[model samples]
Target chain A: MEAYNYTDIQCPPPESSEIELCRILYSEDYLTNMGYMRGIMSKNEYSERALALTEKIINVCAAHYTVWEYRYNIIKDGSNHNKIIKDELIWSENIILENPKNYQVWHYRQLLIIELVSKSSDDYNVEKEFELIDKSLIEDSKNYHSWTYRTWLTKHFKLYNDKNLSFINSLLKSDIRNNSAWNFRFFLLVNNPENYIEQDRKSIINGLVLQKELKFTENAIELAPQNQSSWNYLIGIYEKFNLDINNLKGLSLKYSNFEDDKISELEMQPIISSVHALELLARIYSSSKTTVDKAIRAYDLLATKYDPIRVNYWKYLSSSLNTT
Target chain B: MVSLPCSLKVAKDNTAKIYDRNGKYHGKKQYNEGTIDDGELKFHLKKHLNYFRMLLNFLPNAFQSNDPIKMSVIYFNLIGLDLCKGVEEYNNKLFKTKKERSIIIDFIYKHLVESGEGFRGSVNLKLPLVDRSNEMNESLKIVGNYDPANLSQTYFALCILLTLRDESMSQRIDRFQILSYLKRCQLPNGSFKPLLDIYGKPFGENDLRYCLIACSIRKILQIDKIYEIEELKKVDINIENLYEYVLSCTNYEGGFGGEPFDEPQAGLTFCGIAILKLINKLDSKETNSRINYHKLVKWLCQRQIWYNKYNKQELDEGDNGIYDNGGFNGRTNKASDTCYAFWCSASLKLLKLEKLINVKGVELYLLNETQDEILGGFMKNRKSDYCDPLHSCLAVAALKLLDSEYVRELKDIDESLVISKDALNFMEQLKW
Candidate 1:
């Protein structure tokens, strides 16, 4: 009954792992994954074998979080660097830190941060890294690595301030509807209640409302239809501006009913992106009827386009087309 | 008015009739009353089979240089023959071309080994197997060591065995081993992954084309034991996800996209309907087993804009190959392709609604483009002057299925294999 049995399966662990990795690398036949990595080193013409070794380690260590942090260090320490490179390094660190059980690695990371802060002085943005680590800890409070890293970084880097605000702003900017980002913002704002006058909080909150990513508030609603935060934010903003809020409340009520219906059906659908949420909004906007034309236009804008015939978009369009 | 030596004369006439007698397409467009129109349809029909014949006739000569294009055509032609006529036709042909057949068989044998990891099709490409490694070259055309059409190509490779009537070859394929690879590619919801992911995890539901390709493989190979039908029942009614996926590819107009709902493509429409039909069968209700034939008929009809009483093309703008209308997605008002006419025509016929479609108009459209004035095999688009095996065979299948009288003229030849009787039965079994 088991799908996997040792004798029946020919997929050798390393061979399979390398084959998988090679598929992600350069897809060539002669390049047995180990040989492929060797080829990558030679092809890229790295000055040293250690640099090549670092790349190999990163490629093979896809499943290991600790190795991701180690790989980040190697890339950051190397001379050739850019914004994307720095971003990727931070992403690699975040991925490793996603699993908070690796306390020893987190502890090691803290020691490295202190050494780097003392060595680089003003150059390193140590405070931002601490904030990211703290955010990860908040997501999973039980994660000992996150808590330990947070305490260590806070002591070494001092309180989060304007120096780290840009990083915080970018996360929300990239994905405004992200609950994690919103949660982190609340913590940072409330953590230092005396940072400014009442006017500062209003301005920061207003800036967030006007931010381009506000359009994705619908996306947040789509992900967690029960999430009152986005609705509250919109209502809060509307009330402050003296705009009508009744329609928004009605939409929220409708979504709650829809969520109940979805749960009753017991379909476990994952929420992938903000645009996916917009799909549901397009539905609500259409009053439970098909939004054929608008749906088509929306999908046209999506990079990974949807299928017209399979979706009810075209069925409705066809009906409308027939009537026309 | 009947021609002499029907089979020989018909074959020759079929090839000749496909070309423009007055050569209007070749700048000699003056032919008076009662004459057929001159166009690329003739040339394309002839070219399709001719290109195929070139590989089969000179297969050894072509294989010595190991030309990928020639080999590709050869492989496709063989697979087309099997699909249209089944393994029986292939086995009969194999006996006549035994010596040359051995060479082709040997080439296939080399790749069908466990060591080769389930028959990687065509080793002559320069690209890698996965996509991410070439991230830096995102703008450049993605290349793979294996053809992107590997699943179809492998199915064709398996068809080669069935054609050879090699019972032993089927056993040697380690069907379960290959099925395991194919199963690994399936998504949790019963759709198939297009290929292995960058990290080697199989990514399912790549496209509608691949979906049909995977299904066709299962049908031809009879790979039922690999998956439990009960497990698939969980997703039997879960049409929304697949529908939504395909819907994502639709444009302003009602035309379907390439795969899982790609852009409005005639071939993909056929693919979409076929996949839906397959999914519908799994529901196990006689009433619900039938697909959304009415909607499909509407979609198929939407793509048809008649150019003349005797000619019809797809709704696409220009030549995007078989799915082309006038130019590649240029304007919907342009002429549709003969292939689309056949595909939509056949689809309507399968749904038992051929009467609802413009059968005579399509028949004339295909008839005017047939190889011999009397035999049928239409070109893809009006611009294509030659007919290849794939289109020719599909046109033949479409025509024979639509016109039973034409099929009966073959005298003792069974064309049941042409339209996939087994697939039809599979469809019927799922009828609600």
Candidate 2:
């Protein structure tokens, strides 16, 4: 389907000067294959070469629609080389207003922000990044990348600091099975430093439990027993609740070897493979911080039964033995 | 439906019947050395060679022609050629054919709209260089100007440009200019307008499918950086919603509809499946593991009901798999056609489950029902001989994907060109 051409309505005859300009500039595509070469070069080396070409590319396409794009790339590529990241972004912002639909411009802007966060000598302003993410969301409310960037802000800037429960709730309400949102929520739940604190343990676990069904998180282990992430989360929940040791061991074995006759089935299997779950379970059980000997004994039995390739089980055994 | 018991004996018997007359034991068939008549194995071998031959000969004149029709023909033709090999890699012959190949490459560059940022199908004959020049910029603004029928044109164009080792064209691309065109076409609901700046405001049924194509193209081109990753991240193409929308498109008997929340049609099924594959690539993670890719595979397998003898007449009537009409829900829905088989089957391959299909049956259907032995093209299905370039190319691609040996010869894309699924996983693991 050709775009509905309203050019008939708005396009006036090109002035002779305009036509001449088009002729002079039209065939003059930038000869720089620098981007591809830069793709092959080391970062430090490319930065110097990229700066030189950026000037040429910008000069050639400055008034052309694609110049803003080339210029943006030079800035982004050189972002770490200098402190002028904001200046490059402002140039991009001016161009994006003309082409809001330009995914390249939007992508460049995203890279700039991420660069800013990582390159900041002082801790980056998480709040400002969050605002940008929110603004991106308003542009296209369902963008997974924006949600992903937001998740970055929450982790690094401490923007979602201590409000992990509220954050999880908001994500769940938006789209229950947003896989990225679900994964992000899980990260917050398990890594909540407050979860390790004496007072916040029970509350954090409860918060994690509430968000479980949002992404069908509880069912993931049943559906794909090999999914490491799901198993990891489930084990987190088990340790959080101080579930019975023998029962948990039996549960782990039951879900270990998922059916994998087909490719899709095999792809699904990785979701439940008990690697992360086992490690978390062992850490919870061996530590005097969370539970008693029951959890440790459970880990010991599991290690013995699964015969995993990892040392988490042996470490747990020693820790439990010493504690007892 | 006749129960043709699927056994190796029957296969042997069928192969013998095909080669009974050429009975020179241990003697080679004079046509192509070492292609002897040993019965079943020899016949299958020759059949594959013929398939390859047909595909190679069917190469559209467009690659070498300056004519628009010829150029458009090559647009679909290269896909047919690649489909013959069953993988993404080029053979030594592609590199060896210097002069003719360079002509095609030159044609692409020469016709590229200088004022506009994209390539058009061909050079106009009647129009002067001046008028052609006048129209180039206007034409370029609507990069999505190509139809959903020609969705694969851009794919082929990118492939051709990439194969030519022309980094300058890609580098010269105002990635934003074309992307801007792509963005306005996207509906607020995350679907894409089939055409740029069309419908005033109404969303087309194929918008999501187009969006998927656009994103996949960006991925293939190795310019994901050009897209606003954060912008896309914030958009909520949640798997469940997409899955539900796909389900809603299903008809009572289980065909995919052309658009979201419509009756299931075969072409739309391809579109739906493609969208799902795209979504899976973009957003798969722990919490939404319930989407169940296995069930989708099962559903696709069940959709091949027409292979039954009872539906043989429908095949004869040219109702292959893709349907355009809305039938069961008090409306006539389109049936699955040749091109859709490619789309649907390719979607399955992306999920790595193409083996579940009955390769022989589909091959036979495509050969007997759709292949235009007279013209170097295929119809939508059997009984109809009118060829659409898009469907013709896709049928070849679908058939090639089913041939395991041929697929083995095809190359996987360069790692640098594609983001690893593991990297996607690592990114997903992060808090933001």
Q: What are the root-mean-square deviations of the candidates from the true structure over C-alphas?
A: 19.5, 20.6
Error of 2 at A268 (Å): 42
* Candidate 2 chain A weakest ten by summed lDDT: A18-27
Please state the error at residue B252 of candidate 1 in Å.
Answer: 8.3
Clashes of 1: 60
In order of appearance, the predictions have TM-scores of 0.44, 0.40
Tens digits of per-residue lDDT for model 2, A109-195: 666767776766766454655555555555454354455445545554555454545655575455342333444554465444324
Per-prediction DockQ, in order?
Answer: 0.02, 0.01
Model 2 regions more than 4 Å off: A1-324, B1-72, B85-102, B114-117, B125-156, B163-167, B197-206, B225-255, B279-295, B306-337, B367-379, B386-392, B405-432
Q: Per-residue CA lDDT of candidate 1, range A101-141, in tens?
A: 54323543554555455554347766667656746645543
Assign candidate 1 its CAPRI class: incorrect
lDDT tens digits by residue: candidate 1, B217-295 = 5555554432467764342223445544444433222334443211245566566555555444423354243333333
Reference-based lDDT, residue B401, model 2: 60
